[model samples]
Target chain A: MSVNTTQKKHKFNVIDAVILVVICAVVAAAAFLLGSRNAQSEQNSVTLEYIVEFRTIRDEFVDNINVGVKLVDASKKYSLGDVVAVTSKTATFIGTDFTSGQLVYGDYPDHSDVQITVRSNAVINDSGRYVIDGGYEMSVGATVYARMPDYTGTGYCTQIKEIKD
Target chain B: MSEKNSAAKASGKKLRLNIIDFLIIVVILGAVAGIALRFGVVEKVVTKSSLSSAYVSFLIQDIQDESANYFVAGDSFYSQTHSAEFGVLQSNIQFLPAEAYINNEVGELLKVYKEDRIDVRGVFLCEGIFTDEGFLLNGTSYIAPGSTVHVLSSTIDVTLTVTEIDAVGAES
Candidate 1:
């Protein structure tokens, strides 16, 4: 009777070990599938392109200012009237600064791309507006170009390159 | 009496189960589910705001392009404002002094796109002289009707109407 009882106990132990192994395998497979799915999601990211035309925004003549720095600054600066053409497949215009959709640069050639750099202000007010402006002097008739590349996931404006033929 | 006593004694053998063990398992499961909900999935769908903005921006661009075509089909200033000196900068639709409002409208259009995180649409210019004799003869210039001569900025969009033609500078 003692031998018989010992044999029964051993059989039960074998079954328990098998069950434990099965459970471990199931858990590990679940984890691996979840991990691979996550990596796939990362690979399937989407990007949207926006064509911004920076035209002349406002024209002002600096009489007393030095020409070298100020003129160079103007080349890098872009405003509302700048014309930007995006070669991307599609574009959407959310909103703009002017009521009329025409961007004005002094007199840039039609095909030149407008370059714009955005600087963020640290102050926050009751009005939730993200005010960005440029720090450069613009000639009366110099034209500028602009295009905005905004990400679909992150609410951020990406860099804009000048459209050169 | 001996059989009855043995049966009673066998029935008295202790068998114990702890409630804490079951509770602990439940708590672990609840925690794992919460984590899955928060970070494991379902957060990748595009938000409504983004989708709407994309549609709106595209719509505005189309409208502006249509308006330019309409202007082109008339006895407008754009028909006469021709010359290489005017530069390609102002060559999209034709520009008449009166059409300056259309040019200015782009600024406001950008503001609308701004809410949706899109960039400003292209700038359409009316190619014409600020003066009748072309900015050199007399200060007064006449723009052909239905031209893109107006200029606008994003700052002014907050208080201005997109179609209003009042902000444009008169022909020089």
Candidate 2:
């Protein structure tokens, strides 16, 4: 009896390999392009919220409470942005006790102190104080005044105390 | 060897290219080349027609009496020099006041002045693009956060420190 043995050889396909390499290259190129686009956008623009807090030197009461008060810079020639919102809290202090049989001099009471707290958002400007839209200067100890809308009474008579991001 | 055996050997050694495989290669190459060409052709278009709002904060330090003349605090600040052509867009500044903590229990007004730096916050709408880094105003490139910008004023030399940058329509 004769024994017949057949050998089989494995063949590598060059076309399949080339296809895979092409796919990988395409994916890599796409990723690079998109990544660069994102990076470019990042270096372009940014948005921020500007917050500022000020206090009223004297006691004030307003009907609408949003109008009349304006923030001024140190130059006293320019005006800050419009007062977006104002948060105020009034506190009364009694210096002398009101007796049942005592003479009252002032309108309400002699021993009373009023404190006002206000936080507002001003107009947004570029990254400098050179030419603000309203053209105002803002800084610490920058004297800011608040005027009454229509009623003839004292408004905000104070300066800026604290500023935050 | 027989004639049939020789024919089988010849067939086994012959290289065969399928039609489907060739078509696939051509399609893939075409698509990739198309994409690359498109990417190179298209330019990044920045819309300058619409206006976007930006919020910013900064500090003005050591304001002297002589320079204080240029610092104006009022309803609006109209730049006599700028605001015409070749200037920043319409914007405004709102001076933030310090907080006063009063002890209502003792009937005393307690005010604390910490730093000499004046804190200012502003909101402005201009033709610019919003990006991850900061707001970029059109027709200019100098304005950016953390950069000290100087305003040309007659009385005083005004300098500002950009502290923060926030884009409009983004989550704060």
In angstroms, the error of model 1 at B170 is 50
lDDT of 1 by residue, A12-49 (tens): 36655665666566668878977764564354322212
Q: Give the TM-score of candidate 2.
A: 0.25
Candidate 2: tens digits of C-alpha lDDT, residues A125-164: 3453222323443444434443222111223334443355
**Top-lDDT candidate index:** 2
Q: What is the model-wide C-alpha lDDT for candidate 1?
A: 0.27
In model 2, state the lDDT of residue A117: 40
DockQ of each: 0.09, 0.04
Off by over 4 Å in 1: A1-18, A30-165, B1-13, B16-172
